[model samples]
Target: MANDKTSHEIGIDGAILATQVPGNNGTLILSIQQTSALNNWLLKWANYLQNEQTPRNEWLMTTILIKSKSLKIEHKIAGVSPQKIPDSQYQAQGQRVTWVLMAADIQTT
Candidate 1:
């Protein structure tokens, strides 16, 4: 997905913005700005994750890679305040609602 497009154009880029590996477990962090479109997308994505048995059902897991492999990650809708960026930081970007989601990956060697 092109970075230049406004958040409205793309619901969420299935990108792992950051990652951390500790022992056999991995953590993936993704950020999405809160736009009307993004809010709708998040709800659908979260529902799928919660209801689907196959982790592969999640588009983000299929599209995002960690350590050159598709990760079976578990996620939760983290509270908004901790993940929220200060208005001062996002005002210029026109992003009022922002969320940081963390996905946990259990890796088997």
Candidate 2:
């Protein structure tokens, strides 16, 4: 896909650094306001990854599809799961802090 001809033609492979995981351990950074429902769900999600003893592979495994012609970072991310979610912290300016979730076994197509 790197057949250079014109600009803005870079494929998905070109965005990635290499076969290894990108810096920051492929963490998906997210944050939710205190009033948002996702704030609760995010806490539960992190708890599940930390406390759940038996991980149901069939149910927990997920696939994420993203589409964006603007930046050309669209791809189907499969086998997504909560790899690591440490303590939740908030900034002085905002009530909700950014949570980093590490996901592995990602494949783009």
Candidate 3:
């Protein structure tokens, strides 16, 4: 279903993970690599939910990877959905790593 593009769909460039380490001097540590288009898509979806006032149940979660084995991974994006992302789905491409982020339900309370 991801192959099909809609009018609201945003083209993805890449995504990365930023994690905080206890003794890292409060620095934001980033993973090495991320798949292109993932972050962009999530952001687009998030914005759509906000703009359209859609319910959280209408949103779908996803995790995507680059198709090529030879491609280089750059950086990670933070705060993607956990339900869509799993640890097993990632492979560290040498010095490159990946991050997880969330595009979750919008709540007002």
Candidate 4:
């Protein structure tokens, strides 16, 4: 998704700037802005999702809803990881982080 007025108006703002669904396997790549508040939440959320002790299969079936304009896209959670932004791409406004969320299955609606 592009960082346009439409995208921002639809809820994709500073926190989550963009999203991409690669192929038909339901892999989602989220472009997010890093902040102290988000850092705390991301660590806990990512830890829980990445934990081996958690039931992976059940978690994989979880659905995430993304809304933009009049469109609503649903994605299933297969896995997730929080990655740091390279220094070269860092911006003064805030650090950039990529959150990769994989899906167990892809859905079309």
Best by TM-score: 2
Comparing candidate 1 with candidate 2, which one achieves the higher lDDT? 2
| Candidate that scores best on lDDT | 2
19-44, model 1: which lDDT tens digit per residue?
33233223334444555576657655
Ranking by lDDT: 2, 4, 1, 3
Q: What is the clash tally of candidate 2?
A: 0
Write model 2 residue lDDT over 1-109, tens digit each, in one string: 1122233444677863324323212445667665468767776766775565856664346556777878777665555566454355566654765565544434444
Mark the regions of model 3 whose C-alpha exceeds 4 Å error after superposition.
Answer: 1-43, 71-100, 103-109
In model 4, where do residues sit more than 4 Å from their true spots? 1-24, 36-39, 57-61, 71-93
Candidate 3: TM-score? 0.23
Candidate 4 local lDDT, 38-74, one digit each (tens)? 5557657666766799777544444665545466654
**52-104 per-residue lDDT for model 3 (tens digits):** 57767544433223243466543222223433322333555523434433432
lDDT of residue 103 for candidate 3: 32
lDDT at position 82, candidate 1: 20
Off by over 4 Å in 1: 1-22, 36-39, 52-63, 66-109
